[model samples]
Target: MTLPADITERLARLALPSQAVIDGAHVDALSGETFDNVSPRDGQLLNKVAACQKEDVALAVFAARTAFEDGRWRDQGPRAKKAVLFRLAELMERDADELALLESLDVGKPISDARNVDIPLAINTCRWYAEALDKVYGEVGASPVDRLSYAVHEPLGVIGAIVPWNFPLHMAMWKVAPALAMGNSVVLKPAEESPLTALKLGALALEAGLPAGVLNVVPGFGAVTGEALALSMDVDMIAFTGSGPVGRKLMEYSARSNLKRISLELGGKSPQIVFADCPDLEAAAQAAAWGVFYNQGEVCTAASRLLVEASIKEAFVERVAEVAKGMKVGDPLDPSTQFGAMVSERQMNTALGYIAIAGSQGARRVLGGGQVLKETGGFYVEPTIFDRLQPSHALAREEVFGPVLGVMSFTTEDEAIALANDTVYGLAAGLWTSDVNRALRGARRLKAGLVWVNGWDACDITMPFGGFKQSGFGRDRSLHALHKYADLKSVSVTLR
Candidate 1:
């Protein structure tokens, strides 16, 4: 596994921390077991990390509950919490290169993306929540002549966050930063495939002067670590980002246990609709290619289904294919690689399996239908596109977390709307049109949590980000995220 001299030197200078961070200290698993940390970059074993189990999870949760009950963090004023978060964000910025390198090596994303996109976004997310901390206000309600009534948002005890491998650090902070800003302690379970950055962030949280037990990280498999967190009666809530099946199981765990609040950000088979009268076909094609190929198409809201007006279907797909072919696929540590390896061998195989299924189902492969760069021994797939796909085709309906796009054509506006909403997932959609009326109508009619106009995946911290229907409920980004980590209390007082 060859890397740039600078990156190689940095990797050597940094020592990988294997123990889980609990109660502001790094500790080994209670069971004394460890798992090999494999790099998708070259199918090499990076190191062994503690394979935490239920016993470890229990200890972490107990510590978190103790901290919350003792009011170590929960008792702090909003401004105080904000200051700590700001400090944490500063620490992240200072160690930006190291964090970016860890994320790239762990998740197989391009180093440029890890540095420029993921790290910056995560830093901003933390800073955004920190800045908004003291701005949240309690609400006053209509009261009787002699009485006053108001509602205050109080922090929940403990938030159990199970983040996915796709955007390890960002997703963890999407839950962690908000929960902490709202004054809730958190126990995080990063995905088994990529736990390095989450562990690093946990250490950073401690270094930021966050109270002991306010943030804990248990790195292990979902079944052992995540399931334990979900089922633990001491946990106050469980926030997750993963597959629909796992999300459903977590909800079930919530019900069967103490009915802890559950916030899920699940899968999506999002749509990208392009009308014949699109304002800019060239830009639309570029956005369409990015929507499905960015992050190796592991994004939950990836625009996998492309619905174009029949008149411009061929031209639009051709344009998108050109952009796909132009993308650079190689070692993630490379500075110029646009696309990187899949997170793991399992995910790479899953993507290839879907490609094979598309061929057998009679869909025509327009471009990039198989694996590429076998010499590197890294998991790589071509930026794939399939045409002649029916709405009911499995390739169009299922969430294939890979760089595979399916193209379909529609004759009327109604048909396009219907096609976009035909799936159980309603995470996000993109619509391109020249007519103002059509754009407004399409945005209103689409059964998705977020609708992009002439763009895709252009999200900011201010906007509420989540999904509708089977894509799962509960928002992630905006001020709305605070609601999941808080409990509203209504108070009424009689005046003399």
Candidate 2:
């Protein structure tokens, strides 16, 4: 396995912490089990992490529960909690470079993206939620004659957050920042495949003045630690980000065990529409390339389905093909690389299987379609584009979570809307058009949770983010996310 020149330098500069830290103490797993953190870039062991089990999950949850029920975290006033969160955000900014490096290595995202985009966005998300914490207003309702009604928001006890391997550290911050700011202790279960940065985050929280047990992380397999957290009766809520099937299972488990509040952010096959009225075809083509190819197209809101108007479909696709041909896919730690390897060998295999299935389903590969640079020992796939896909085709319907774009043409606005909303998942969609009326109409008609006009995947921390249908429910990042972690209580007063 040959390491990319840039990765070799980055790895040499990385500073890794020892495996265990719990309640301000360094220790191993309860059973002394350890797991290796492997680099997807070269299939080499990076470090050892505590191989947390069901018992470890129980311990972490118990710590969180104790902290929420009897510790300083729950006792801290909202202002104080907000202050701590702000400080944590500042600390994140201070360590941004190291954090970005860790995220790129653990999750296989481009180094440039992790440094310039994901980490900064994550820090802002925490800072934004922190600022919003003290400003959240309770509601007052008018009552008849002598009575008054008012509502007060209070935190749920302990929140169990299960984050996916893709964007591990950022997703963890998405859940933890708001939950803790709202006075809820959190038991975070980062995906086992990319758990290094998450474990590191736990220690950083402590350094940033978070009390012991207020934020606990257990890194392990889903079947054991993940399931335990979902099924724990003591847990007040579960916030999960992953596939639809796993989210459904978490919902079931939450329902069965004390009826915990569950917030699910699942998969998407988001559509990016380019109409005939688009002002600049070249600009739209570049945006389309970044929309689907960034992070190797593993983003839940990635525009996997490109719905081009028949008038300009051929030209636009040709431009996109040219851009796709130049995407550099290699080690994530490389600052110059645009596309990185998939998160793991299993994910790589899954992506290849999807491509094979698309070929069997009569879809024609227009450009780069198979494995690339196989000699590198890294799991890399070509940035593939498949054209002539029917609305019902599997390639068009399913979330590939790879750099595989499915292109289909529509003739009318109605046809475009139909093609966009045909999928069961409704996370996000994009429309490129110069017509004001068309943009407004498409925004209104699209079934997605978020609509991007003339661009794709443009996100802000202040805006609420979630999905409409099977893509799962509940918003993250914004003040809307804080509501899920809080419970509303009404107070009625009688005035004579």
TM-score of each: 0.99, 0.96
Q: Candidate 2 — which pairs collide?
A: none
Q: Which ten residues in a row have the lowest lDDT in candidate 1?
A: 369-378
lDDT of candidate 1 at residue 6, scale 0 to 100? 96
| Model 2 residue 335 CA deviation in Å | 1.1
lDDT of 2 at 112: 90
Q: For candidate 1, lDDT tens digit of each residue in 1-496?
A: 5678998899889877799999889999988999999988888898899999999999999989999999999999877888899999999999999999999999899999999999999999999999988777899999988999999999988999999999999999899999999999999999999999999999999999999899999999998899999999999899999999999999999999999989999999999999999999999999999999999999998999999999989988999999999999989999989999999889999999999999999999999988887887788888999999987788989999999999999999999999999999999999999899999999999999999998888779999889999999999999999877889999999999
Best by lDDT: 1
Q: Write the per-residue lDDT of candidate 2 for residues 1-496, one digit (tens) a residue.
A: 3556666776688876535455555567899898888878777777888877878778888788888788588778877887788888888899888888888878778889999988898888888888888877899898887899999989999999999988888899899988988889988888888887777788888888899989888877888888999999999999999999999999899888899989999999999999999988888999898889988888899889999999889989999999988888776777778898888888888889989999999999998778876787778888999999988788998888998999999999999999999999999999999999999999999999999998777778878889999999999977888888999999999998
CA shift of 152, model 1, Å: 0.5
lDDT of model 1, residue 83 = 87
